[model samples]
Target chain A: MSAAERSLRGRAAIVGVAESSLGEVGPGISSLDLIGQATVRALADAGLSKSDVDGLFTHSAFFAQPVLTTAEYLGIRPRFADGTATGGSSFVGHLWHAAAAIEAGLCEVALIVYGSTQRSHGGGLVASGAALTRSWETPYAPRIPASAYALAAARHMREFGTTREQLAEVAVAARQWAKLNPAAFVQDDMTVDDVLSSRMVSSPLTVRDCCLVTDGGGAVIVTSAERARNLPRPPAYILGAGEATWHMNISQMPDLTTTAAQESGRRAYEIAGFGPQDIDVVELYDAFTINPILFLEDLGFCAKGEGGAFVSDGAIAPGGSLPVNTNGGGLSYCHPGMYGILLVIEAVRQLRGEAGDRQVARHSLALAHGNGGTLSSQVTAILGDESTL
Target chain B: MTDNVRADVESLSPETAPGTVFDRYAAEGVLAYQSCGDCRQAVFPPRVLCPSCGSDDLGWEPSAGRGTVYSATVIAPRGKEPYTVALIDLDEGFRMMSIVTAGDDGAVAIDDPVTVSFRLAGDEPPLPVFAVEADR
Candidate 1:
């Protein structure tokens, strides 16, 4: 496709990706400290220096103007800048926006970064709830995203015959993946029973079903496809990406069991000229156990009501037919407020065969999906190594 | 953008905006939603412009006070009384988030028919909650 066209597959590539100190960094660490650390390492991994950067994309709870703050911190003036913050999926949306900028020759060496210290600062639960825009539901003290998500989960279960065991399977699989990843927040063995028996925070979802509150930051470096090919690390080519949102409030969503991932995934796949079966590995923003199931169905991996069954029998776990969230995902991995950046980092690692023990055998095309708000913003990206390109 | 940000960016005057007008209706012990004059679409959490039609000519309409529970959940915070929160679809063709005052905790479920119940406490602003009514 032409640069002027909407499609941007293989027009830009992710040259480097890295993460800062994960799990917990203590009270002394700030969100910018992690962002700076990750930026330095990520630029180095891309075989590029600070002077080479011209485009900057970032999202954070720490800055009202994320790009401007990050640019001043890195001491560089970017020709292009964006600070679009739509919650957790903000970073993933950055990837799509970055590629478009590159293809349009707006700038070169785009940096997409994110950082958070919610766990270290404490009040992760309270802060998460407060972050959600409240109104009619505020008086009732619904646990913000968790309670909102539980409402959707309950409806899905009632409509599709999905059981708590099916939901627990997602957490168990994430824990299994966590055991192989040292950077994971929790690496202990977990089972369906364990997840089911864990403390219930919101009905239809237990504490175990929720994502962890941990401190971490991650960054990705993007450049033109030609430049990325000459970088030190194997380029994770941007095959296709798409973003869509239908509602901000959980109650406003048209359907409880469905999400906007359906539209986002379809747009991404159409742009990439490929479907889910072509993807080798999958990385989904699993903020809650029900997230993967909902995304799986909406992303066309399975029929709408079949997500519960598709995830059962170790489907997305390490010894399974399909590899997912090899870096442990938000469920067992570190979730530093916004998790979209980590999703991109994990996909790039898998595509480049840098995932170590958790690496999938056929590491070519990978799909990363990010969810923000109460399943509000959905951004899907399809990335691949040079082979697929 | 988050809805909060959108609300702020497109904020209306206090006499017409979501927060104030809705508060005024609550103070008078009634539930109201915005009805677009152009599209006739029912808008909850009122907006200056009709989200469906981009029409600025919007007016308020009182709800018939009955709805169906589209979804429900119980937030069981530690050492606190669990309460039911639900997404209710009003018969007037709009949906809203509300508290479900059921006979038992976690008793409300999807598809349950409910009616509006007022919680008009002293000093605090009156708000609407749903009562899971027994089948008659």
Candidate 2:
């Protein structure tokens, strides 16, 4: 493909990626403090200084002006800033925006960061039942997040004959991966029966099926491919990026069995000139167990309604056909509200051959997919080694 | 129904644009949805402009009060009685979220037929909850 055709392919790369703290960071630490720490660490990993950053991107429900607040706290005046808030997938969307900005010569170095104290201060991921429109649904006291996702899980089962065991397999697979990750919140073995017997937060979903509510933050530094060569770490070149949103609330989703990942993944694959088979590893957001199953189907990894079978028999487990959520994912790893940033960080690590024990042998081409809201927003990013680029 | 069914409803303020009209219809024990006068399509949550045709001509119409359960989930908070929440696909081509009360057993399931029922929510209007159809 021509450079003008695939504008972002190999044009911009992730030079550095790091996290502030994996699990608990205490209640005393504010979100801004975590952002600052992660920013400093990521820049240092890239062998760059704070003065080299000219663009900033971040999103937070706790902050009114996320980008502005982060820039001010870091003592740097960014020439370009974006505070796009579409739930967890906001940071993945930022990667594409940053690449576009660099392609347009708007900025040379872009820093995307995220931080949250949800576990310590915000009651640990419980749904408050606060509705945006006070629609007819609010009076019934619906448990948010869980209830919202359960609706989709129920529909998927009804339409595809998906079994509860298939959904439980996703959780088990993530825990198995978490065993290798010392920073994971839950690093123990989990069986399908263990997941099934866990306390039911929402029907078809147990407490084990949900992501952890912990205090954590991460940052990714993006710059032009030419500039990335001089950085300390090997760059994970951007091969493709795309984002889309279907609905904000679960009630308004056109279809409960599907998500916007289909559109977003298609656009991303087109830009990369590669298909699902070309991907060697995947780092998909796992706020809920059903999310990865749904993404696998929607992203064209398997036929529609076959997600249940696709994940069965250790398909997504380590050493399986597809190694997904190798860093334990949000299910067993740290999920501080918006987990989109971690997905990209893990992908960059795998592409750079620095994923430690969770590393896959063929980690040249990787896909980092994220889901925001109740499957409302979707973003897909393709990261690859220089050879693939 | 048992006394401990835990189907308590809460009322919301009707000062907002969307709530003013939706609340008025709920108070009358009618399940109403917005219909675009231009494209003759149905819109949920009641908006002034049609989302499909982008026309400002929107009107309200009483729904048939019947739908099938698209999906269902039971919320079981610790130390609290579990309640069922569901997504209902209306016959008129609109989907909504609501509580499904299938008696004390609470046996609502996907694809089950359901009909609208009303329960008074404080001083505000009566809210809609789906009851599993006897035939299902």
Candidate 3:
């Protein structure tokens, strides 16, 4: 079954989406606490209780565990449980799997959840000295994520004449959107000077270009289109979803500047029987400033080697030709470790016109894309109006 | 103080380090990569097996430490000095990221010749540094 022929379009809809307190909640809160809160909230939004859910999916890397942990915490006994861990893309992949499970009659409803103590507890993205591979990267000490990313940035600059200012522009645009989002972390008035003056975490990448570590959780409830008609909000129909991995090591990649999102996004569009032009808005996962630039190209928004410039001229800003990452993004919004889940939540909100100040007018279709690993793995999902169902 | 001496002096020691692949290279001075017999492909970041072939039949191979800069970035500090970092496309086909030295003549161009060196920082192993490969 090639993705282009999948008929899952509009078979399922996202009825509910919720999030626990983003940023630092408190010292006493556990990762599980955030997960439980978001799940309960999502179920309540769907007007369903624990007893109504028969399926569940969560990131294996995240401790959604004890099986009984989330089920007991939410007071439900689900017949289906999925702990698919493909890094950051876990949530988007779960949506597809949940849809299949429901369509296959394995369960009536599925809850996909994610949570992390990345900020309050810290040590989330920090390099561990114990990993055996550290020995190789430790000598030159170029193994830190920023330095590693610089290697790719250097390649992009050499290959396409991408400039530091071009990369800085992405940070500036994200900050502009962040200023509009009440939930964003680094909402201070940021300028190109602020980005250039920022301490270098890696060459071509500044600490300012990086995302904030946060403690947060987001969850969504999925069910048949028939059930979605009765939910609190209009359902955001699942048009299509797809995921893939290119390479694990940054050095082994055929091209550091390009991402697997190209293939993932292509497959997703084909599955939904839509094209890139059909997308009215986007919620691209931007863990780092360069991520979305690479994503913009991979998703076919512009030709390759034009990512750095395509973002220029305020094309992605609120009033630009294409409004992206409206709820601030992983770059500006709270990035709680595996932030891919939040993209789905945000996309659904925008499509439903629920985003107060960040909403894009008449958002008929939205693309939610997530990058895992060091831009090694990718997941792209296309969502549309429930009337399409 | 002088370009020659600074190029000789190593940076980044093991004492102030993390568990990274470079730490081993710094301490051993061996440019090692993951080689899969199954796929005849050599990889970096020291994977357990070949991601291409999914075979655990993999071994660490020492590189000759020879390559060319696939790309480079020369940074002019906002209020500080300038430095360069590069992606060296190794002879083994894998790429190694390191600070480019040996030339203060502006930026290193793509395909520029480079060889591996080490920088000693604190108690940590000497960090991997690259110098222009005159022969290339």
On DockQ, the candidate that comes out on top is 1
Candidate ranking (DockQ, best to worst): 1, 2, 3
In terms of docking quality, model 3 is acceptable
Superior candidate under lDDT, 2 versus 3: 2
Error of 2 at A22 (Å): 1.8
Q: List ranges where model 2 is wrong by over 4 Å.
A: A1-5, A126-136, B1-16, B103-106
For each candidate in turn, the TM-score is 0.94, 0.94, 0.83
lDDT digits (tens) for residues B53-104 of candidate 1: 8887777777878989898888777798888888899999899998988754
Better of 1 and 2 by DockQ: 1
> On DockQ, who's better, 1 or 3?
1
Q: A1-389, model 1: which lDDT tens digit per residue?
A: 34453457888999988999998899888888999999999998999998999999998877767778888888879999988878899888988888988888899889999888888887474243234544666777788789888988999999999999999999999999998998999998889999999998888999999999888999899999999878889888888888899998898898989899999999889888789999899999999999999999999999999999999999999999788788899999888888999999999998888888898899889999999999999999999888877
lDDT per residue (tens digit) for residues A88-172 in model 3: 7878988888888888889989889877766777546622123544433334445345555666777788789888888877888
Whole-structure CA lDDT of model 1:
0.86
Q: What does candidate 1 score on TM?
A: 0.94
Alpha-carbon shift of residue B136 in model 3 (angstroms)? 3.3
Considering the true interface contacts (CA pairs under 8 Å between chains A and B), give the fraction that model 2 also has: 0.90
Q: Pick the candidate with the highest lDDT.
A: 1
